[model samples]
Target: MKLEPFLLEILVCPQCRAPLNEADYDGHPELVCTAADCGLAYPVRDGIPVLLVDEARRPV
Candidate 1:
């Protein structure tokens, strides 16, 4: 996921209210919230963010 710098700055963890970071999955990039306390990662596909927990996949 190629999130704009401005957008990334404002993105928050839906579960933890923490900051976000970028994580790569099998060469596929995504925006993730690593609030260790939350233990969930939000994904982005085809330039669209899939923020649902059910839509997310475990890193392979």
Candidate 2:
């Protein structure tokens, strides 16, 4: 599914509050995160955040 503009507006890297782009797809890599500034990512599951700093990874 395509991301909504408002969702994008409110979304931040969570790790660095940089910016977030679509990172993964449904049942794919799972987490949808991006942080070009900090070079970090945050994972989302079932539309919920994993929120664990260790769980975050660099977007592939």
Candidate 3:
């Protein structure tokens, strides 16, 4: 699924309030926190972004 550029531009990491960058995770689209200290990855399911910190995946 494709996230709108406008939405992506406004989305931030719930963990650190850092801007989120678009990336691919397991062949699916995801949003990754730009803060190196946080390194959280939020998944997008059915065009909806799951931005909860508890739901975010830690960087590998």
Candidate 4:
């Protein structure tokens, strides 16, 4: 799945309000928070981003 560049530019982490970086986790697309203190990973399902804090993966 591909997210539009404009959308990606505007998308931020719901928890930290930091920029999100596109990444692949376990072969699945994800949006990872750029904040070092809040490294949450939001999953991308069916080409749509799930930005809810409860659904995010906590940093290991």
Candidate 5:
């Protein structure tokens, strides 16, 4: 599912509170932290952002 532009604008990283950028993770669209050190990818399920840190995926 696709996230709305307005929602994307308000979403931020849970770890660093940094701004998130639109990205693709595991063939699914997600909101990835912009901070290079905090590479957390928050999944978008059913067009809703799963912002929980425990549910976040870190880049290898």
Candidate 6:
């Protein structure tokens, strides 16, 4: 599911507080951190962003 534009604009990485960009990962929607140093990918489950740092996927 796609997130609302306003919600996407206000959402930031919980770890680094960087702006997040929407992306498709493994056929699922996700919010990916834009910071080079902290590129965490947070899952978007059922149109709700799971911003927990522990639940974020570390950049490879």
Write down the lDDT of every candidate, Cα atoms only.
0.71, 0.59, 0.89, 0.93, 0.86, 0.91
Worst 10 residues of 1 by lDDT: 51-60
The true-structure Cα RMSD of candidate 2 reads 3.2
Q: Write the per-residue lDDT of candidate 1 for residues 1-60, one digit (tens) a residue.
A: 567888888878676677778887768777677676565677777887776767665433
TM-score of each: 0.73, 0.55, 0.90, 0.93, 0.85, 0.92
Winner of 2 and 5 under lDDT: 5
Which candidate wins on lDDT? 4
Q: Write one digit per residue (lDDT tens) for candidate 3, span 1-60.
A: 778899978999887899998889889878999998999999888878999998889999
State the lDDT of candidate 6 residue by residue for 5-57, as single tens digits: 89889999988899999999889888999999999999989878899999999
The collision pairs in model 3 are: none
Name the weakest run of 10 consecutive residues (lDDT summed) in model 5. Answer: 1-10
TM-score of 6: 0.92
Candidate 3 segments exceeding 4 Å error: none
Instruction: State each candidate's clash count.
Output: 1, 0, 0, 0, 0, 0
lDDT of 4 by residue, 1-60 (tens): 788999989999988799999999889999999999999999999999999999998878
lDDT of 1: 0.71
lDDT of 3 at 17: 94
Ranking by TM-score: 4, 6, 3, 5, 1, 2
Best by TM-score: 4
Model 2 stretches with alpha carbons more than 4 Å out: 1-3, 25-37
As for model 3, its CA RMSD to the true structure in angstroms is 0.9
Model 5 agreement with the true structure over 1-60: per-residue lDDT tens digits: 566778778888989989988888668988889999998998888777889999999887
Q: Which stretches of candidate 1 lie over 4 Å from their true place?
A: 57-60
